[model samples]
Target chain A: MSTGLIFAGTGAILFAMGVAGVMLLAHLLRRILAFNLMGSGAFLILIGLAQRAGLVDPVPQAMVLTGIVVSVAATALALALTRRLHKLTGAYTLPATRDD
Target chain B: MTEFFDPLAWLILLPLFWASGAFLLGPTRGARLAIVGVAAQLWLAIDLAVKVGDGGTAIRHAVGGWGAPLGIDLIADGLAAAMLLLTHMVALPLLLYARGYFAADASVARYFWPLSGFLLAGLNALFLAADLFNLYVTLEIVGLAAVGLVAAGGNATQIAAGLRYLFATLIGSGMYLLGVALIYGAYGTVSIATLTPLINASAASAVWIAAALMLLGLMLKTALFPFHYWLPPAHGGAPAPVSALLSALVVKASFYLILRLWLGPFAPLTGTIAWLPALLGSAAILWGSWQAIRAVRLKMLVAYSTIAQLGYLFLIFPLLGPDGLALQAGGMQVVAHGLAKAAMFAAAGAMIHVTGRDAVADVAGVASRMPVSLFAFALAGVTLMGLPPSGGFLAKWLLIDAALTQGQWWLVAVIIAGGLLAAIYVFRVLRQAFLVPAQGERRHLSHRAPPLLEWTAFTLAAASVLLGLRGVDLLRLLAVGSGP
Candidate 1:
């Protein structure tokens, strides 16, 4: 397989693992990390698929940079929210979905 | 590209400019600037609509003089213009209401103006975006801004709700980006106009996966049925103005993206999967309304009702035809729900402000105590119930007409049944409001709501009802630049 396909395949595995972590994990901080992993996986796939033929494409590279910025903002916000929740309620996981 | 005056770019940049200006100006002075800014946006939106309607073509703009396939493009058609107008119309009154609502609480207002500014800017850019990657960025802007607004309450419940909303929105946008990546890999282009013909020419597996990923992500964001768990808490727990903005506009933004993609590049692949959204929509109508009826809190009821109402927007997917009747019906539903839901949430906010409580049962004496707000709530309920002289009535009428024409009797049944269920939940609140409180149950009013707050809610509710009479013009506008 081409280098691009190989990297995309790995990215797909990472994405699956990230999704599983997000869904099955109870810890909010871990969930945030998993979310980042999911984002990174998608970014990898974006760049990998574009370079499947070994020709460096600037478009997906540019998109990956933009994606990373958005990911950072999202992560920071998530961390802030998690910290606030912990400060206020002293809990790491969300309350039961049916608690309301 | 710079030669001609472009209202599209201004519609976006104006909000971002005012948002920053508001941030630096502080809460009190910033609010006035926000009002002025939104008023200008309303005018620009109206002008764009008139221009698109009169010209009968979509207006397209390439950023920095770089054409598509290499740079971003923005396009505004009748459908987009209508949404822009709707956003501003709802926003103008809500801003007025928010100013009065948050007058005493500077903390919430401090972030509300700038965040809402970012939200409106993101919405405008999303509506005008002609490329998939650009849409993803706009989605993130809207998602983050909305999450910040929800968390602005800073209470434990609100913060937790915000965190849940944050995760949900992040997942939604992440999936959407993956879909965009796949589309890019498959077609080597992200522009909608360029990809439409190309996608129609091929039925590759990658295209199908991209469509599925994008649809699912948008569904989660729109809070359609099964994925709706995160919505009620985030929308219900936030301050009233935040809830109004979220329920009325934010969800509709993602729904619009779904419709845009379905009608554009994914048109050919949509036939086989058309029934999926409609099926889920039927479930949402039944399930969400039932939950709304059971909700103990007033805001939660309105929030749950939002889920039910959003289901109607998806019903048109299955009924789409060459005549565009389903499209018109969906547009009408979106506008009607947008106005009525905003009014309902605003009225509920007024009631909560006066009563200083959030429970449905606590509104026992609201009818006599705050007649204007109670009347506003009832008037909005009229629209939700799909009663006469309301936009909801006209939208349902058109939807049923289209369904009957297509021989989809089941959809007709779901539509009618959904309206009936809506009436139950709406009346549940009204009945409580009109009830006479027992001797010991009477609660003193915590504070009198500002007349601005009550009147703004009333005006929006009245406008939603009045839309029934003038829907033809909107329908005509919806037809501009669309296929026959």
Candidate 2:
């Protein structure tokens, strides 16, 4: 396979896995990690797309830089919220069946 | 030529600038600054709307004097302007209502002002951005700020709900960013204006995949049916004004983004899956209203009604052909729902404040106790139920006409059923307030809402009705920059 194709394919597979994990797992921490995995997979696709020529595409690089900052902020916020949730409920996984 | 510098950018920047100042000055002073800032932003919004509506041209601005493909740009078309006007109009009253609603809670009020401004900035930025990546960034800001606002309620329920909202929105943004990456890889640009023609020429697979990915992400953010589980709790748990803003403004911003993208770059490719969102929307209407009918809490009922109202906007997606008339129909639906829902939430907040509980049964006899607030609720309900002489009626009329012209009888049935369901839930609230208590069982709350709070909600409800009375001008304004 071409290098770009292989890399893009890997990103796609990782994204699918991350999505499945986020949806299936009830653990909040695991869900956060799955989000990170999703972000990393997306980052990989951006990097792979940028490698189309000898020189990387600067636009996607710029976007990836911004994306990294956003992802970091999101992870931090998710962590903060998770901690708060744990403190409030005394456990991480949502209480059995009471959404309200 | 003035080199194309547009003041439309200030509609976003002023709120952001003031938001920064508000954050620095603290919440009380920040709230005062927000008042001045939102007022200035409203002035700017109206000025831009008048000019754009009159000139019949979009106002485009390139930040830092850099053009597209290399630097970001902002465009204020008729649709974005309509949303801007709606935000400013609704925000000002909500801000005023909040000033009184949280008058005693100094702690929550402190961060509330800045977060609200930041959310408004994020919204205006989302509507005005001309690029996909920029839209993603603004969406992130909107999501984070909304979570912060929802969390501002500070209870365990609110915080947990906010966290769930944050998770859902973050995933949505991640998926949206992936689509942006794919589009850039295929077309070498992320600018919406640039991608319009290129998207039409690109291979069908790449285009369809990107469109599907992006629309999926936006739908999650929009809380369309299956993904709508996070919205009610988050919205219901937030303080009244925050609930109003979240339901009225934030969710609509994401929907507007979907409208902008589909009508702009993906317009040529929308013929394939037009029925999908319509089907989902039909389901959301049926399901959301059914849930609203059974909702025990007042805020949860309003939140579920928001889900149902949002479905109306999506139903016309399949009907939006080259005529672009259905777009105006959708736009009108947005304005109708935004105003009515804001008034409903604000009034509900006032009632729940005095009652000291959110359960529908808890609000019995509050109708005569808080006549102004109950009147506001009933008036907003009139608009929400698509009754005549209200914006909801005009919007529904236009929507039904569109569906009729397109011969979508199933959607027509959904539209009618949606109105009936809305009527049931709305009167459910009113019934609790007005009908539950028998004669001589009348009562009054020891803690009555200030007249300012009552008037604010009434004004918004009145505006929704008055908007219908002048539907021509609003439709004309929406059509200005929406060229075929």
Candidate 3:
């Protein structure tokens, strides 16, 4: 396979791994890390696709750039929330038994 | 460029300008400036509405004077302009209410106004963005600002709720990015309009997977049914105005994107995707209503109600397919639910402030003590119940009619059942607040609330009721892109 296709396939596999990690993992922090991996994989795939197409489209690349910023913001906020929740009720895991 | 003359341009800039000024003002001044900022935004929103009505459509500047497929485009068709109007109008009152509520908390002041401005800018920009990637940027601005606002409370429960909200949104945005990337790989473009014509290959695994991933991501962010675990606690725990904004507009922003894409660029994909949204929406309605009925606290109950009410918006998808009564009803339900639910959350916020209690039973005698707020709550409840002279009622009526017209009996059953369940819970709060309070020993409010807070709630509730009468106008606003 060409380098571009290899990178795209690798990114896709990483994206799937991230989704699976989130689904299977019990730890919130790990799940967060999985989410980051998923996002990074997506960025890689976008760049790989642009390269394969033989042109750099600013649109998708810019979107990935913006997504990185948002992911960090969301992660920081989640971490802060995690710290606060631990302080309040002393429970770390999400309460899986939803009444509804 | 004369494109700057587009009123939509100001709608975008007004909030950004406010964010800049709010940051410079800092904390104490920021709060006042935030209120002023929302007021100005509200006015601009109104102006945009009028201009759209006259012109039939609205589109503003291209970022660098390049057209679509090159540089970004920011356009506000009737649907977007209406959303913008609703958002700013809701923000205006909530900010005023927040001014009074957050007056004493000094530390949070630094982040509140600027973050709120950022949130508003994100919301407006998201509504106007003409490209998928541009929409992504706007989503981040909103996500960060909102998470900041949630954690600003700095309590353990608030923080936990914020964290859950963050995880869900992050995973959601991640899924969204992946989908966008896949579409770009296949189609070589990211503008939604450009992707519209490229939506072929229905049997293709990559295409279906991308669509599914995107839908799931949006569903999680929108807090539809099974994915809604994070919503109730976080919204219930946040400061009242923040809760109101989150419930009223923020969640709706993501849903609006789902709507924009589903109806606009992804129109062809609807045949495959419509069933899932409709199914998830049904589940959300039943499950959400069940939770609302059993909720202990008034705020949590309202939060659950939001989950159910949001589901009502999804019912439009299956009905929106063909041009028929079902399609019209589905479209009308969107605006109806938006107005009614926002009113409900604002009213719930006001109640919490006046009574200083979160429990439903403790709401006793609130009607007698705070007549205006209570009246507002009841009016909002009427809307929720789909009773006459309320937008909620009209939306439901249209939805039910559409369900019947489309022969979707299950949806009809769910809609009616959900409406009945809604009435039960709404009355539960109403009876506890107004009548039960009379039977019990009357308790005085421990604190006096500022008049502005009460008025803000009352006006929002009144607007919801007024929306029922003015359904024609609101529906017209939504008509910019899709016709009834």
User: Which candidate has the highest lDDT of all?
Assistant: 1
Interface RMSD, candidates in the order listed? 1.1, 1.7, 2.6
Location of the lowest summed lDDT over 10 successive residues in candidate 3 chain B: B437-446
**What tier of docking accuracy does candidate 3 attain?**
medium
How much is the lDDT of residue B351 in candidate 1? 92
Q: Write the per-residue lDDT of candidate 2 for residues A9-53, one digit (tens) a residue.
A: 899888888888777788989988998899888888877865776
Q: List the residue pairs that clash in candidate 1.
A: none
Query: How would you encode candidate 2's per-residue C-alpha lDDT over B210-273 as one tens digit per residue?
Result: 8888999999999998899889988888999999999999999999989888888988878778
> Candidate 1, residues B7-107: lDDT per residue as tens digits?
88899999999999999999999999999999999999999998898898999888777877777788999899999999999999999999999998999
lDDT score at residue B258, model 2, on the 0-100 scale: 91
Q: Model 3, which residues run further than 4 Å from truth?
A: A23-28, A53-60, A79-100, B201-203, B322-331, B438-446
True contacts kept of each: 0.68, 0.49, 0.69
The model with the greater DockQ, 1 or 2, is 1
- RMSD (Cα, Å) for all candidates, in order, is 1.4, 2.0, 2.6
List the DockQ of the predictions in order. Answer: 0.76, 0.61, 0.58
Q: Could you tell which candidate, 2 or 3, scores higher by TM-score?
A: 2
DockQ of 3: 0.58
Better of 2 and 3 by DockQ: 2
Error of 1 at B258 (Å): 0.5
Candidate number with greatest DockQ: 1
Tell me the tens digit of each residue's lDDT in model 3 across B64-113.
56878677788877778778888877788778777877777767766778
